[model samples]
Target: MSNSSKAVVSFIVGAAVGVAVGYFLNSDKKDELVEKLKDQKNRLKEKWNKRKDQLQDELENEFA
Candidate 1:
């Protein structure tokens, strides 16, 4: 009922859904799929880092 509890529940639900999707998507070509997923994960991480840096710069500009 509390905000923290709601957030935790949401995270658990989302993780479960993600796991189910991944499991269903896996196949005989697991090696290829794994490589593709690794590349996608790296790309996502790069994008996230860039966004984080940009947000930090913006916050500094606004607050400093």
Candidate 2:
């Protein structure tokens, strides 16, 4: 597609995302949603840290 077409598509997608985020932020359940997102964030961080540690240990063993 042309550059102009791509730009238009990107703009539309961005606007849609902005609207959705605005709706969620304005909703009554916003606090609940935020709490759930925070919990999910924590879970992902823990998982990532665990995986990183495992990889580090494997690399150390390989080098040793």
Q: Write down the TM-score of every candidate.
A: 0.56, 0.86
Residue 25 in model 2: lDDT: 98
For lDDT, the strongest prediction is: 2
How much lDDT does candidate 2 score? 0.99
Clashes of 2: 0
Error of 2 at 52 (Å): 1.3
How accurate locally is residue 26 in candidate 1, as Cα lDDT from 0 to 100? Answer: 81
Top of the candidates by TM-score: 2
Q: What TM-score does prediction 2 earn?
A: 0.86
lDDT of 1 by residue, 1-64 (tens): 9999999999999999999778757867778877999999999999999999999999999999
In model 1, where do residues sit more than 4 Å from their true spots? 1-28
Q: For residues 1-64, could you state the per-residue lDDT of candidate 2 as single tens digits?
A: 9999999999999999999999999999899999999999999999999999999999999999
